[model samples]
Target: MEPGSFWTALIWAIVPMLLLLAAIWWVDRYEKEPLRLLGLALVFGGVLAPAITYALDRAFDIATSLSSQQIVPEPSLGVGTPLVEEVVRGLAILAVFLLVRFEIDDLLDGLVYGGIVGLGFGAAANFVGIWNTPSLGSDTDSSLYTSLISQLNHVFYGAVIGLALAAVRRREFPILLGAIWWVDRYEKEPLRLLGLALLFGGLLAPAIAYALDRAFDIATSLSSQQIVPEPSLGIGTPLVEEVVRGLAILAVFLLVRFEIDDLLDGLVYGGIVGLGFGAAANFVGIWNTPSL
Candidate 1:
């Protein structure tokens, strides 16, 4: 490991990846994750995972040193190296999971965190891969390119694993829906009517809103979220969305007049509709639900 090569590799690797991570964080339109948490995840990926991977790889090499076949044919580093690296990276991704349970603002937020870990992991791996290669000194430019390609591969795999790991937060949709049901207390809306409202509010109405929004967007060149009854307003998506949800409930109320007895009944039914819509919209989920 030449000192010059190591510094060159480290600089090249860290700078580009940090920029990419910043881009990912910036492109997040709806929610901005805390920079503190993002920075923490980057550290976990770049430092912690690489150190652990090195240790594990060394241990494996030592464990297999005395093997009869000289560690060549049966279980070579080819298969084992990637496995070990990914598992270590995965552990780092898991560490990220612990940092942002409550702060995750969107589904994309989870993906951004996963991406941060991956970019960091890839960046750090380049330090090792590029420094060890003798060609890094003689063929600086080409070596840097190859190192970049390798890092991209690492980033790709790590991001994928991170995306998969993001799903493990596990939210139960019915919990809040059930709470809203409990709020009716007296003269509860019929479950049949509630289900109708839930599905219509959660699924059907949103589709209608999307179609209308898209139609306006194409005609007016406004953002999809901005295109609607009020083109000047960018919050049209939510406006239309809430109206559609209310219509679904009103449709149910009209169809089942006996069930909606008073203001309290309407409130309970309306709350359920909103919860269903929220669950589908990614506005609320298992991670953010106030269970109590």
Candidate 2:
């Protein structure tokens, strides 16, 4: 370990873990859980459970080595390591279950918590693995990639264990599974309409706004440089931009009226319009920006 490697390693390790946890938290969006409890679970799985697993694994490894004639033992992927790590993580979940039985209201809840706990463990393990890698250089890139893959593996295995432990109501499984299937089964919007909406919003809207800005430049004391007494680009900008955007939506509505069945349908169309406009505008802005 280098002198200041501790802080560097801690930062790299904790950041990715935090991001992964955030994603898991979002997945449990329908029924948000207590952040404090989840944080604690993270700590238990990352810190406490890993420590317990390490001790048990080392002890078992030593015992097995003494009994068996295996000359070199592979600690990293040894059967003992997975068995011990999972059991320890499962115990952490069990402790939470005993104290907060109500929190596990359904199988979904169990799956989320299980995945979270696993993520915590993965975070710590990833930190250690990455922290120990060769100093930041080309070689470390592969190490970082492997670290992410392993962490995800841990979360997946943890979720599987969680599902196993949860007492699921069989009747609800079909409904829950059907909802996912339904979302996938929905019809997709045409790409041609999407492209047209984007072009209108991005190119046509900007061009119209520029023209209007120049045309409305009323100057009391006109000079070549100060011909257009600096207009409030803010107020008129949004109004012009929105109207142009609305025109795009109106075109879609007229052409594809059948698509707008309800509020959700309208929102879907509106979202497409907004997304296309924003994407094109941003792309152009980035392309035209002086910094670039």
Candidate 3:
């Protein structure tokens, strides 16, 4: 193959693999692993490990070719190259486990990380497979099919490593469960109440701010015209804005007094209200700002 063709085939083969890897990443939606560790795992498993495995596979193939003694039957995939490849991949996973034990939180985390490592391996392997297949007289469709199958195979093998890690963790499951239960029993709050508080606070904050601003302007106008000889406008705007933003929390308190069970709950509700008001004010400011 020409250099351009080789590069194009490699890109085509690797694109789907990357998309699948991204999907695997979303499986651990919350509390993602550190980027550096994940990157390291991909590089080590995908590049370094494959290079080592390739060298070992070549040595095995050379020894088999040179042997004079006749074996009853040639080694099948179940006991031959497939098995060796799995072990080589497993070694990569084992190294990650030993180096970064803290990151392996649960079964799902193991599955995600293991799948990533496998994805790297599959991508490296597919690059070579896609590049070499045309020389072996395989069609483009056949090369694509092989690439897809190889990616799936590697991801599945990587998931097996996750299963093993899960099993290891499960041995102390009872102790872990008991601790979790105790903590949850003490700190549990209804999801519905929290959602309601945040929703009410966010939606009501802007309206409350608007009403207070109108009322303050009217008062200021009245005071300037008749009630006060001098217009005390210096502190009026800041005072009105701060109090108006704060009224959202008061509204929440009136709406769901029972939900605010503790000081921490109050702080959370107040923070949400402030966040909403600030967001609204920011949007208005940006929308009014002149574009360059």
Best-fitting candidate, measured by lDDT? 1
lDDT of 2: 0.58
Candidate 3 per-residue lDDT, tens place, 9-75, comes to: 5785578777977887787778788888788778866887777766765676521111211122334
lDDT per residue as tens, model 2, 115-190: 8788888877766655544553332343344355567767866765565445432222333231212322355556
lDDT of 1: 0.60
Q: Write the per-residue lDDT of candidate 1 for residues 1-292, one digit (tens) a residue.
A: 2323767767877777867776786767556777799889888988888778767756775222111111234355466645777777877887788777776544455567777777887787677655555542333333454455555556656655554444345431223222554445445567888887787777776566556656765211112212123233333433555567668778767866777665456655666666676666554223334444
Candidate 1 local lDDT, residue 95: 77
Q: Give candidates' CA RMSD values in order.
A: 17.6, 17.7, 23.5
- lDDT for every model? 0.60, 0.58, 0.59
- Which parts of model 1 have CA positions greater than 4 angstroms off? 1-4, 62-75, 170-292
- Each prediction's total of clashing residue pairs, residues at least 3 apart in sequence or on different chains, is 1, 0, 0
Question: What ranges in model 2 sit over 4 Å off?
Answer: 1-4, 60-78, 133-141, 168-292
